[model samples]
Target: MTRTPETPLPSLKERRRLREAQSLSQADVAAAVGVTRATVRSWENGRTTPRGTTRDAYARLLTGAEEVTPHQENPAPALVGAATGPVQTSPDRAEPTPEPPSETSPASELAPTLEPALGPEPEPGPDAELEPLSPSLTPDQAFDALYAFCAPALVRQTYLLTGRRELARESVERAFQLAWHRWPEVAMDRDPAGWVRATAYEFALSPWHRLRPRHRNPEPPPAAPADRALLDVLLQLPPVYRRTLLLYDGVGLNLPETAAETEASTPAAANRLLHAREAVATRLPELAEPKELHRRLAEVASAERLRPAKPTTVRWGGEQRARHWTRAAIAFTVVLIGATTLTLRTAPDHYEPPLAPGATVHGVPPRVAPGPLSAEELALRAKLKGEIASGPERLVPEAG
Candidate 1:
């Protein structure tokens, strides 16, 4: 019988830190595991957890015999791995993981074009051990802390993606609302902020974008050529490239972090970044350099910081409670009205009118016979009767 494997030793975050420590690219690990880089990332990010054989491989790769020892003199920890062990590398892959540079090393100043490691990294969950303070925080408290820290950055990045201030505000608010409703789960995530960011990203692209009227004039009157060129090129780039560029350079995330956010492999993200930069460089040679590109992107992101902070407007649970009360109140009122109407129609006591003094109510009035005529009227009647009896012969003789 096959022995049951032990549960994966390290958390997803631990595994990613291990990969970063090893300086192995994600493609390398993907090759060793016979799976895609995205699969490894999913395991790391808690999007879909690893199980069985996958978990086995994940544990082995992360918990390998290599250990990085810290030094007192040099602050940066050293990365150590078995020289003969399995390490993945593509034949045509030009970039290699650079050695750690010393504090004063020139290499430390340059941003190495490194691809992200294959494995996903975990962010600390809200319930995860936090420094100092209370032993336990309510879910609301945890969510509030997260919201306070992440809302501003989320708003700025969302605005970069949408280019509409109001829409970006709405997206961030709505995403936070979702986060609020799922507080328990969100509080347990490695990076709750990422969850909110991804949600906001989706909201930014919602079909509602089409229905809203454009706030900015499509064609502005007179602007610098470079500004016009940069805006046009940035907006015109494919969403993947545009978003990747913004996340990587504008938001100042490393390759691995950006890859995690985009759900793309480190290699794929690098490729997109390259193409996007090239596209911009081709259009606007003046800002073609990496430093210049980053400067421009940073400037754009910085401008958003001056905008007034908007508090998270979503309180999903509160809203839901209010709705429940309103619905119950309406139902109760309808029932009361129906019962009142039925009582008035069916109960005699309710329908009967009050009796008046000395009067009996009747369904119909009583009939009266004709009364006796007066004395003058009786004498006239007698004369008329006699005249009628002799009228025919007397009237005819007179005529003759």
Candidate 2:
């Protein structure tokens, strides 16, 4: 007759002590599988066996312990042996007999021995579902997507500045990488596509690129490459001015939206835009001809239209435009108020008491005399009257 050997079971306290002995705190285990420390404590207390994935982790954690596995099949036998005495088994049993418990039981023995092999595993809980990895896009894949959407304008801008196709490509590529890393944050922005283009230009002019020896060389300046001149002008402009221009003209973002993006005061953004427009007009006189500039700008803008259409779904259009109008109105009101205040402060005081009615002196408003009109006044009045009478037919007989 074949005989079966019984396994031993550890009490709740023993399980908790084993976990502590291995220097695996409850919180540490909980964090690995995305659960709370309380759950781990509950499992150790025998109040519960970790359900689902957590139970799986618990099983893996106790992998080396012979007693735990045997107990899984026959819980009563394991508990009896653990509670009462050494488990006795028939010689005919195929399974090896568990050694009598030493001062350190097998559970304790297993804890320290397995600690090195056990890694943090995901904890099972109501919320412990496996998360999918973020989808990856190859550099070329990203470039194709971005180029199709905004490449034309970015290219034109690059050519306008660097005059070199390769340099423009490099600048755009760097900007795309930055966008990819911050896709979540950038995607939510009002003009994410434009933001990417601006970021690329910024990356191109970053100190790292400027430090390149080729940039420092003062060779006869090459002829302005049609494609690179724009990029050059942008890089030459200060960051604030360049950003304002890009947000306004390049990204098609209005003033208030641009202000929010650049963290500028609305008036400051407007002033920057004005200054940028002047600079561009001065540098690229060709843009002064509205028809030609618009045509070129349209080509670039259309190219960006090819970008994935979904990113533009965040409708910031109405709200942002309204914000810009409101900001402009407020600015205008402030200026009006300031000008009025200044004029009031600087004006000369000219108010004087009105002259008494019918009073006169030399045909001007008369000042009050110390006494009423006397003989002197009468004599002076008569002389004035005589002069008037000598003039035009005796003053036209006093048109009374």
Please name the candidate that would achieve the greatest TM-score relative to the true structure.
1
Model 2 stretches astray by more than 4 angstroms: 1-147, 159-165, 182-191, 218-236, 282-286, 289-400
Q: Who wins the lDDT comparison? A: 1
lDDT of 1 at 91: 31
Clashes of each: 4, 19
TM-scores of all candidate predictions against the true structure: 0.51, 0.32
The digit string of per-residue lDDT tens for model 1 on 137-161 reads: 8665666667666776667667667
Tell me the tens digit of each residue's lDDT in model 2 across 251-361.
Answer: 334343455557665556657865766676688887643234434444432332222222222123324555788999999999999999999999987978877888864
Q: Candidate 1's error at 178, in angstroms? A: 1.0
Q: TM-score of predicted model 1?
A: 0.51
